[model samples]
Target: MHVPDGFINAPVSIAAGAVAAGAIAVSLRGARRELAGGSPTAGFEDNRTAPLGGLVAAFIFAVQMLNFPVAAGTSGHLLGGALAAILVGPYTGVLCVSVVLLMQGVLFADGGLTALGVNITVMGVVTVAVAYGLFRGLLAVLPRSRRSVTVSAFLAALVSVPAAAAAFTLLYALGGTTDVPVGKVLTAMVGVHVLIGLGEAAITALTVGAVIAVRPDLVHGARGIITPLKLRVNGELVDAEAPAPDPVRSGSRRAVWATGLATTLVLAGVVSYYASANPDGLEKVAADQGIDAKADQYEHATADSPLADYGVKDVEDERLAGGLAGAIGVGATVAAGTGVLWVVRRRREDPAAPTHRSAGTAV
Candidate 1:
């Protein structure tokens, strides 16, 4: 959930900000290894990984805008932690969700500026960390198959939402702006979020299964799980020689990117129009538990921007204005996310970097 301003006191918010910043810093470093394909000269594959990562972020942003009805009065959406981690990697997944939160906060005014850290901590760092950990653990125990990977993704995502909700409950216990029973709030938050988790699980499973079907190599979590075909020799199974890395097909890459971008645009600009209007898990919980009684108004410079509240300011047609806003959001998120990830990938490839220098000096 996008935490608005004044939900958390200044002290806890500042602490969460520091935590979020630290997590991002660490993720940036980890993302380097992931984007580089686990080697220094991995820049050759950057063309494939970098753009795919950006597309994942954009897709997550668009899908998140489409909130599906959960219970009678509540709705839920994809948090994207497990989906991104399965498609990309854990570190990159955190970056992807952070990028979405930043874009939503600054550009769309969907999340509050002051609460950026809270949103990042709860929705980005916590979700990614928990989901990816569970995913890896399950992958270790499960059979080495695409189905297993999808199953892990589903379970990981299902648990991550409530984990994040629990984190938020702990944070609110420390810095909530209003006086409310922490126990009841915790119970309600976790309860409602569990329902939301079902939706998250389904979306994650479907998406991961689809990617694994098409390009299992592209899925970070599925790596090494899809083994080479074995041969029976003398009634004994032998590992087959691994295939060579396929040449980069620029046309295929372009096609996939174009198709993904088009799908994101369609979802945000058209499908989102029919999304459930009910309040999400967090909002419903807050209202029911009286945690939002002292909620402060969202006061940001861009609060009055044309695209604020996911609608154009002067556009009279609600549908058209919302569609334009969604389209713009998709474009902006892709551009911003792609640029950030490109820079990170390039930094990893920097030959003059300190790590390279030290290694050279040692040699």
Candidate 2:
């Protein structure tokens, strides 16, 4: 949920900001290991996951443009924190969601600027925390199969939304700006989001399952769960996921990149136009809770941008303007995301070289 302005009180907002800052700090270190190099994630070091994380962020952005209605009027988009965390590692996932949030807040103005910290804390940190926690817990109890991983993805995503609502409630309780009863806000946010969570679970599971099915090697979270590489022993085929080769040669990576880029464009340019025209989870919560009483319209507000408000700035034809806006948005997000990801991947690759040192990393 993109928390708008004026919902949480100053103290609570500041507190949430501090919490988000700390989480981001922790995630930066985690991202370096996940991307750059080190133990616990040697296979998933910085270079590999960084560019991948940026792509995930951009994908989340494009997917969010295509909101689907859940309840009668309320709707939701991919929250992405859970999905990203499960697909990537949690530390990198946090960075992924943060990137998406930052883009939305600054460029798209989808989320409030003042409430930036809250949005990241609730949507990014909380969802990742909850989803990853649930996924790990389930993994421990369930079989260590690809199927189990998919199942975990489904359940983790389903639960993350409501858990996020609970976190929002606690934050509001700490720093609510209005007179609305905490119970009402909690009930409404959770109730509407439950339906949204179902959509999230489906999307998350399907995406994770598909990636695991194809390039399971690309999925940071599924590193150990790969089926042993099939091999010949006598006359029978040994069942095992293939071991990662020392120097990974490009295998269908071009195809994967092309597919991702194509998918992002289609979603942003075409499918987004048909997405449900309804207020999403946070918007609804704010209206219902009187938390949006002071949501000042965004500055740098795309009011003049040709694609301002997802419509061409001056194009007279609604269809044409919207189409162009969508196209532009797709291009921008893809380029931005690809650039960020490329940097991360390059950094990850450097650490693998014998002459590299992991010093001088700025948090």
Candidate 3:
């Protein structure tokens, strides 16, 4: 749910901005460790984290356009926090979503420019923190298998949607511009988002399951859960050592990236044309509850942008205009995300060191 500018007053907006900035700074430092492999023996293959993170950001941008119908009138799309965290590390996951938000705000003009911090805090920080925290906890308690990891991802994503709704409710309560009753708003936001969460859960599970099926090693959440091969030595079973890092894996990684990018392109450029046209959860709730009474005063600063409202400004064909915008958005998100991750990766203390994790070791 992208909060518009007029929804919140200046003081609360500034406060939220400060919080978002601090979280981003902390995440950047944290990302260095994750991108560097989080261990001394991590192989160069761990370098895959950076580009994979970029792809995750672009994929989120693509999927967010596909607003699946929830209730009769409302719809919801993937927030992607749990999916990103499960595939990449949590810190990188935060950066991934943030990159998507930035691209949407600046280029597509989907989210308000002034409410950037609020969007990042609610959508980026809250979702990742809640989903990743719950995911790790569930993984700790559940059976140590790939299935458990997928289940945890599903549950975490399911809860994260309402968690984000609650966060927005709290923010509105603190500094809402309109005089709407907080109780009704809270109930409606959470209620609809719960149904949306089901969609979120399914998508997160399927994506995580698909990734795990092919390359469990690249999935950060599946790292410690997928058991390594064990050999019987004189009637006693022992954990087999991890195989040597292969040179051929680089080509394999290229293939993975190609497949992922192709999927993202198709989702945004072609499939998005069929997305639900009804209002999303937040927009519907705001309209139904009169939370956006003052939205007219604070119009989007980028309303005049060529790609405003997810369409090309002068394009007559709705489908073609939207398709071009979505395609452009995907490319912009990938480039921005990759550039940011590359900078973060460059800041590692020992860039040359291979920080490899043993097979089946917890991160």
Candidate achieving the largest lDDT: 3
Residue-by-residue lDDT tens digits, candidate 3, 10-54 = 898899989999989998988877787775335434678889999
Clashing pairs in 3: 41-355, 41-356, 42-354, 42-355, 42-356, 43-356
The Cα error of candidate 2 at residue 272, in Å, is 0.5
Give residue 131's error in model 2 in angstroms. Answer: 0.6
Model 1 scores a TM of 0.94
Ranking 1 against 2 by TM-score, winner? 1
TM-score of every model versus the real structure = 0.94, 0.85, 0.94
Q: What does the lDDT read for residue 79 in candidate 1?
A: 88
Task: Evaluate all candidate structures by whole-model CA lDDT and list the values in order.
Answer: 0.88, 0.77, 0.90
2 against 3, candidate with superior lDDT:
3
What's every prediction's RMSD, in angstroms?
3.2, 5.1, 5.4
What is the per-residue lDDT of model 1 for residues 1-363, given as tens digits with 9 covering 90 to 100?
Answer: 888887898999999999999999999999888888766565555577788888999999999999999999999988898888888898998899999999998888887777889999999999999999999999899888888999999999999999999999999999999999899989999998999999999999998898777777788998889877999999999998877765665676677789889999999999999999999998998888878877755476578777898898899998999899999999999998888889988786566755535545655
Better of 2 and 3 by TM-score: 3
Full-model lDDT, candidate 3: 0.90
